[model samples]
Target: MTSVRQGGTGPRLIVHLPCAWDTSATYGPGDTVFGLREGEKCILEVAGVNNGRVFIDDVEVSQGEHGRYEWTAAFFAGRVQIVVTSSDASEAEYFASVGPSSEKVADEQFNAMVGEIQKFRASLLLGSSSAALAFDDSPGRNKLDSLVGLARLRLYAPGFLREVWEICRAPHRSLLQAERRVSLARVKRLHPLALREPLIAAAVAGQTSESPSLELLHVATSTAVQTFDTPSNRALKALVTRLAAQVSTLLDTVVQGGLGGELQEEESRRPRREHFLRHLLKETKVLLTREPFCSVSRLETSAASLTQISAQPAYSRAYRHGTRALLRGVEGARTLDHLHVSPTWGVYETWCFVHILSKLAERLDHFGWKAIRHGVVSAAESYELELSSGIRIEAHFQANFTAGAPPAKRVGWSLSRFRIPDIVIVVQSAARLDFLVLDAKYRSKRDNVLEAMESAHIYHDSLRVRQQKPNFSVLLLPAEADVPHLDADSFLFEHEVGTISQFSPGEPGVERCVDLIADWAMRDAP
Candidate 1:
């Protein structure tokens, strides 16, 4: 749907996308074709030049005659760029905005996925016992790795800023006792200790026997005044200041992480991300200049102040939630620092792992289960959720399982060279250890689903745990519509291998999958 016209004598590039609808016109640095569903084939035809090469997402594509390049890629969501370069170095760029086929609102779905990831990262920060939970050790290190954390900040920062601004506009004030010198006639409540000196001076001046002159009797009086220098206000200011500093740090990180270099020319031609970060920074700066935040002294954030804010009916929601989210955002930025600009499939895969773990935790709670160790699993770069009910769920994200790998790294022996699954769940109980291999495929197409199921088959047949095969090897797809009923019945449920369609955060389908897995784990519980 996107049409590009070269300004001068250069190779003309036209991209034909398989979009379900045309909602808007072309905009931004590159021409964008909207409503392009995920897993659809797109064609790029370049004319008026020979020996020209086409690149989709910076990878050169094999082209046929007439410079026609067809791309039938995997489950790719978000903006994808197509660059066509001629032998003379003339280049034309076009972008394709791909969305989920199941959901109409692509941004909402993507934001929801990011929110889930943030929640997961937050849980790790609180539940992790190992030192490997450090930010530098995060998986998927890339220059744009901070984008995910930034996206989370962008999603919640506006509301947080608004709340802080509102609080500053009418900040909490309390009556504070103060001492000031006042004339005898004006002093309503004079302090006895402070009046002694004035009385002694009056006696020395021969005024003690008679009514002391109002002008001569200057005594200190204790009075109360309503001021904004309360503990809650100071805490509010501290949190806002911390928020501003963190946001500024994030902006600097983005700029230093090559936002305007290769990302500018290749991946992100539009300055939307940079612009968003700057806008957030501006908002935080403006909020800091408001009433209480400007005048109130900084107070170290403590549990008592936070609890006070939460206990107050007026400031509870805004201050309490704002402070918690600010802290969580900081932790998320650190923990998920390396997860920026991850592929859509990677995002979905991580979401599945977190979503399943959360649901399993809830399920285990019914059986009086408590978390014993929740954090990174040593140097393997995996997350582990261990419960007191003799159940430990360790998630291996894109881990290599080869014969030569260490025991901690290898889930089970694979007959092949190396089997790297998207997510591998190892449920260790008192009686037995069960392995559940889940392959997250963002693609919903029938062919892509069948191809993705091959991984489930491979894990089921090849992976051996103590000479026993895996109990369950499932393919986690995006939505229910992605899998056909016939295929689900004939190929998935009939065998030990299954398909958990609609396996996304906050989706109802997730409960069924969680129950299935939790039941399997609880069966081996002693």
Candidate 2:
């Protein structure tokens, strides 16, 4: 619970929010969340159009998402004068108000609606296809559609925390303001794992018969290393190690669509390089009109409104972690070459789109779309360059070699044009480099590394390019995940070059896979 004191001609309005549901929780005091309430009268500022004061009916008003001024003030008694200023500072006025609570819902109703929505969405997710989510007209066909707290932008606590921290430290002349932002950001971003992890593990282990525990999804999600700072570096690294497989989806998206597809279109109406997304959007919109089914949803559907609502939040709008990935998969429509596409693989889908968006957003050079507000990026401003470039030299072979044949090899794909691995790594480095090669194996579902190591013979044989040496290779292994237990050695795969190196990427529980790979690239540099 939080409390704030506000000034008025009448008794001070001391607002107490137990659940912290108000936007004031985000912006701090002096925001409208507390200012507008029953029996309140105050002048409301309307400035953009012109400096004008509107006498508001406070009791009848309600607050909007991100819009605080959309409220009324009720003054049964003599009005108290308070200066209301437009966000632009163009308008200011004096007035009075009773107080504001018109926007706050009954706590019980608010929670029930959230529960209902989660339950219903959880049910829909289990279905194999959109057809599986048809309108049954049953009692449970749909859940409560409460407009308040509808779970859109259900912020990750970390996001809120970080935002609060920044707001406090904003460009105010006073350092105190900045300190306040830092405090808020910390609150939101603080690790909730101690409270959340055990439940998440139980959900993962139990496999409940009812709705799939979103807790597992939350675990996978909250488990990500999305932020970076010297202080949080340890936790970030851990998340990266655990979430490495998840991050791969992002790179796979780039391999699919040229991340700059819009930049290469016919040059007549081409905007700036930054406006590439604008072009993509124009193109996608055109496609939506001409080939709607082919472009986004694969199936032809009669749920036009539902489709429109679903597609309104473009693939680019979500957080950097997965927004690009989801968009890329939707636009490119394929997996990372090796994985098969499945309905439940929305993780893979969203993953690809977010990654692509990250790349495209970083490289865009113009600001036209930023002003127009298509609602894709966080702002019109460009994103920082991607810290990690997801690329590698991949050589895959579809055909196995004949026993007596002098080995002829095929390179499925080699990213030599831009990226080349400084060191060729073999899985466990056991296979003779000339005979087989394994990059990195990341399937906890598999019992032992031996299966991956044994399979290397086939991959190694395919790579039989008789180099000067025995073509020995190296396997990159996570030192923390049981490098010792795997009994890996340079000779594990029957080659001198085979080896294992152990180094945990981050703290025990917080790092991601990409962070670990990045660590390897840093440490592995010769």
Candidate 3:
């Protein structure tokens, strides 16, 4: 590990990962430490600063003996930023990349997983053409309330801004023709009608029409001038201006409201967010000063003008996608507010559920199962697929379940208390209803995998469908190395609890898991 000094003064920051093979590394601002495994704990010590505070991913770390601060990497693979602030106001920033410990899984593979999750979320919303999925009104359990604002700034704004720029660069120009008095020499194309007026004026002025002083002679010439003040251009300009203002207001609300502390931590423990906002504001102002935007006479965004904009191919893509992103706001189902700081476990869980549900839907289709209702579950952060074969698959995002709740709200009731499994598959036949509960555990370690299996056992024992235990309960874990302890066949036959490891997108085992569930559903079908 290479040591980098911070400002050539102040304190020296040292990082120690007791779990890793190379246990120690020195880091400074803009430095990244690699080879750290996900779920591993690390220690940070700041030399030369006795009373300083340490923050990892914006959460302050508790000081231990000898002024060492510890933080555990999250279960998912991603990069986390750390900041150490001294009493003298000096700060040093560092980053750590957590990857899968297994040699079988490459670092790119884990990074690609995160990317795929993000893409999946965007596609989910984009694909829902007319689905009325509302934004989250309340703060999420993750406490990042203004996810819509963050999505506007982070995900959608860049592309939208690029499209706006493209429109500004070569905007749709409209030709304007006006009848005005101009010198005879200025008329490039001497129209006969223009000459008639000019000859009449020359005759009145007592001068020869042909050889009259061109400067002295005037003509009623019709001039065609290309201008950027078209209705389409005005509409585009209006949209950009309104979007910029709305984004500014949203940022202010997010920074000053509940998301203040969290966003501050995300912005490098400094005023980096302020700097970014300021840069955006400046860029927007500059964009407005450009040709089309500036030349637009009025910021009137009428329906007809907007329709005109959509008619042209050059402006349609930006207008359509940008308006959609703005109007849809933040999806409560896929909250990406904290993705920059840390890719939360909920994201991984949702990805696993979607993957399994998709594969299962494909298998069911092969068996001639047609979807009756396939869309987002109303008033909830989940997607449901109801097949013609009486099988309903639901992928929930942190939905709650309680024994006292209504039947429509509860996927399955807990005999003792409440249970909220990550994924649930309920198959209702004419005779009986069979349930398959799946809990996604983002752990790859042996101990963690075993601990997560307890959830499966608990769900299998407690959750009941029509006063009966689920036919099968499974734990979906990240890696396959440590889950050989729980045999799938015996657990399903005797205990009704099992584990499916390495159940990720594009994994070969995904098909097998989907097949197993499909087989059970087919067997129970009426």
Highest TM-score, which number?
3
Task: Give per-model CA RMSD.
Answer: 12.7, 34.7, 9.6
lDDT of 2 at 517: 27
Question: For model 3, where is the 10-residue window of minimal lDDT?
Answer: 125-134
Against the true structure, what is each candidate's TM-score? 0.47, 0.20, 0.56
**Model 2, span 1-526: residue lDDT tens:** 4344343232122222323334222221123333433333322222233332222211112333433344322211112233333335432223332221222222232223223323323222221111111111112222111100111111121232233233223211211111111221133333445345654445546855554534233322222232212222222222222223322332333334322213322122122212322333343233223312122223222343334324423311212322222211111212111111113122112222222222233333212212121111111111222123322211221222223323233212221121111123211122322222323332212244455554444333333333322143333332333334443432543453332433112222112323322343233222
Instruction: Tell me the tens digit of each residue's lDDT in model 1 across 1-526.
Output: 4544434455565556555324223232356555566657766666666677876654567877665678764444655666667788766656666665554225577668766666555332221100012232333323333443454464457777777777766788778899887776775554557536957456546766786566766776678988777777777777667767767777776666543224433234234446657888898788777777676766656776777687776567666445444433333345432212344665677777766666776777743333333322221246666677756776566655665333653336666666777766677766677777777777666777877778888988877655557777888777665556623535555688868777765566687778777777777666
Q: Give each model's whole-structure lDDT.
A: 0.60, 0.27, 0.62
Misplaced by over 4 Å in model 3 are 1-73, 78-98, 103-236, 256-271, 282-295, 300-344, 358-403, 407-419, 444-454, 461-469, 480-492, 498-516, 524-526
User: Candidate 1, residue 16: CA error in Å?
Assistant: 7.4
Clashes of 2: 72
lDDT of 3: 0.62
In the range 1-526, model 3's lDDT, one tens digit per residue, is: 5455444455667788755535566655667666677657787887777578877654678999877788777544555666678777767666677765553355665555545544444322221110111233223233333444544464456677788888777889888997788877776766656546746556546787366567776778667999998888887777778777866776675456445433434444335445446666677788899988888899887887888887898788877655644543333444332233224354456667656655776887843323333322121355556667665655454445566433663445677776677776766656666667788776667777778778888888877755767788887766674667574666557877877777765665577678788888788565
Best by lDDT: 3
Ranking 1 against 3 by lDDT, winner:
3
Q: Model 2 — which ten-residue stretch has the worst lDDT?
A: 146-155
